[model samples]
Target: MSIFQIKQKTSGAVLWTGSAHDEKTALDAMAREAGYADYASLPDQIRAGGVQAAKLDLIS
Candidate 1:
């Protein structure tokens, strides 16, 4: 799994930091952490442009 950093797209606030196999998985994880039943159930702000996930490069 790769490390991902999830953040609020608008304000750019850090929401979650963890590992997932891909971007889709990371978004799903974010939805879960935000208390949504699933990614599809997440609010439009989140699903559309409220949330963002980016892969991180860890320093050795």
Candidate 2:
């Protein structure tokens, strides 16, 4: 597993930080952190410019 960090694209604010096994899990964590039911529930703007996720170094 690896740590993931989600941030706001525009403001560059850290939104969510956690460990996820895959991209899907990281995206799910990002969506939930933004208070949406799921990734599909997020608006286009939110998906495009509001938030983004990147895999960090692997967890020991």
* Candidate whose TM-score is highest: 1
Per-prediction TM-score to the true structure, in the order listed: 0.80, 0.70
lDDT of each candidate versus the true structure: 0.84, 0.82
lDDT of 2 by residue, 1-60 (tens): 888888888999887889989767888877887788888888887777867788887656
Candidate 1 per-residue C-alpha lDDT over 5-36 given as tens digits, one digit per residue, 9 for 90 to 100: 98888789998899999988988887798798
Best by lDDT: 1
**Candidate 1 Cα deviation (angstroms), residue 44:** 2.3
Predicted candidate 2, C-alpha RMSD: 2.3
Enumerate clash totals for all models, in the order shown: 1, 0
Error of 2 at 6 (Å): 0.7
Which residue segments of model 2 deviate by more than 4 Å? 58-60
